[model samples]
Target: MIVRHDAGRRPGYPAAAAVFAVGMAGTTLPTPLYGLYRQELGFSELMVTVVFAVYAVGVITVLLLAGNYSDRVGRRPVLLTGLAFSAVSAVCFLAEGGLPLLFAGRLLSGFSAGLFSGAATAAVLELAPAERKTRAGFAAAAANMGGLGCGPLLAGILAQYAPRPLSLPFLVHLALLVVACVLVLLLPETVEDPERWPRLSPQGVVVPSEARAVFVPSALAAFAGFSLLGLFTAVAPAFVSGPLGVTNLAVSGAAVFSVFLGSTAGQSLTERLGARRALPCGCFVLVAGLAMVGASLAVELLPLLVAGAVCGGLGQGLAFRAALTSVAAAAPAEHRGGTISTFFVVAYTGISLPVVGVGALTVALGLRGAGLTFTACVAVVAACTGTYLLRRPLPERNRE
Candidate 1:
């Protein structure tokens, strides 16, 4: 196998990062538009979470079955296919008139995200100079969250001010996907002499025993952090419109965008703090953010809610990036893709399962009350993780 080591050749990392961001951006373009869908389809709040969870379902399924495919098949082919999934998802949303299309679109988006999570990340890292690996990690994390952040921001701006809120965003996304496809085609393949493609089958969770200790705490932190994201992506808009009386789609989109922006900021902190210190510190911040969220729910305050989203998002970003970088660094090159996929499996589970719980609780507690309950639960989990990390921090090398 002849892996490219001449990072100086053309520095294709930027192009890879751009493709990563574009693919990821499409998955989240629907975040701020869920409310409009609810209105058009006349679905209950519970159904909204259900629609969102369906996407998570698709992501988790792909991670389990095909998460490591790129490791064997080469990065370019998997990325092209993932981009295709994203474009099809955009088309689904563009043609959406009811719940079925919503679910289908979300599922396809989830698949795209699952494929991107491991492949795009590996590609970006591989394309970077060894000396620039840290920077590459930042770029990858930023593209993931930054792309996600831009999604709502783009959709909200277009939806609030432009015509055909639903149709326009997807159309824009489809165009971006086309651009991403072109970029992928132009980039060199990272994996050299990859194994021949085999019949597809589930690549069940496989964590090396040596890495389990590090993986457990890292995965826990991710789970807690992602739960906050789930709350925002899946439910916060309803909270904004229903209780806070913010009907503007742009405002709601901005609110979601704030958390992701905070996350991007938080990821930048990881290099300075080291992954170990960053993890606990992030957990503490996450707890505080969740507290603010609960307070906002109680008092029905918009600023407090936004503050919570930002703080919690920053915290989530910090811990999540640290967790991902540390875990990816620890894995053997041969197993890197599968290990990263496993980490995402745990993280996405946090995003899906807890949000579904919140949705179910909404049936009885209403949105605000259920949101409060979620905030409390996640805060407690984060606090415990933080406390544990503080006492028994990962080794300094692992922390790197």
Candidate 2:
């Protein structure tokens, strides 16, 4: 187990960020490959959504049950366990023969991500030197978006150019998972107590009383932002390959990557705007992105689709980070993990539920029609949230 010293210079923050990046990248490795699975497995769009929802269920379960495990047992143990789940997930994919295996693979992948989300973020922040806290936040956010973006791009390239398209990508990711596990071993642990291990029990979702007002708006913004991310991650590849006449896995992955790239760019601007202003602005930007996405579907324009990805991703990044920062600032230190987990539970629901609805809609309507429908719904939600945030003022100090 890696042990972090409270006094001595911490291990390199960027290094910790890199570890986080690789872990997150592994979580999204399946994004670009969904089309391949659909074709090979002969599953419908609805089935794909079901598979995706299964992953979300796994994520929610872990977050609800083990969200604060890292805090009690230390970051390294939880992170290592998460990576182990990733390894198992890759193995499931590699051995996949039917729908059950696919479900298992996604479920394991979700479990891995659920554990990593909180543990890795906390680890990255704590590993940073005292003066670089802000940079540390950026590092954490970048690693998340950058790594998620990289997953599809890497898988797409390997699956397109490399032999054994479906099998090879998972195998390559398994190797990367091994490397990440070793890196986690080398990293210093941030939690102070090693001996005081608590028996595992569910940590009920906790939100600070003071943060309640900010929580509603902030969580709503998060729901909208994550809903956008869910679209690309869960369904965009099928849309690209089906209606847009883009079949190459690499190209499909690049489309997904564009959104995440936009998110990273959007996050960089958060420092200049402050959290309150950024939250509403992000919602507006997301609506604009959704509009572009709708236009792309109407015209079958690939460039427009790419533009939508970037815009939507940027909007998600801006709103999500601001929401997280605000919620963290408002939450009491003692219940921080539970509060953050609760936040993510809501965010993941956004990621899972709306996309599932789109999948169901795709079964009746065609992909384009479903795309337009999703765009309209999300646009309405984002517009309303943006208006609410803009009309109200932020509390000067957290009530709690």
TM-scores of the models, in the given order?
Answer: 0.94, 0.95
lDDT (C-alpha, whole model) for all candidates:
0.88, 0.85
Best by lDDT: 1
lDDT of 2 at 129: 74
Write the residue-wise lDDT of candidate 1 on 343-395 in tens digits: 98899999989998998999999998899999999999999989998898886
lDDT of 2 by residue, 43-114 (tens): 999888888888888899999998878877898888888888888888888887789998998899889888
Clash pairs detected, candidate 2: none
What ranges in model 1 sit over 4 Å off?
7-11, 329-337
Which residue pairs collide in model 1, if any? none
Residue 313 local lDDT, model 2:
87
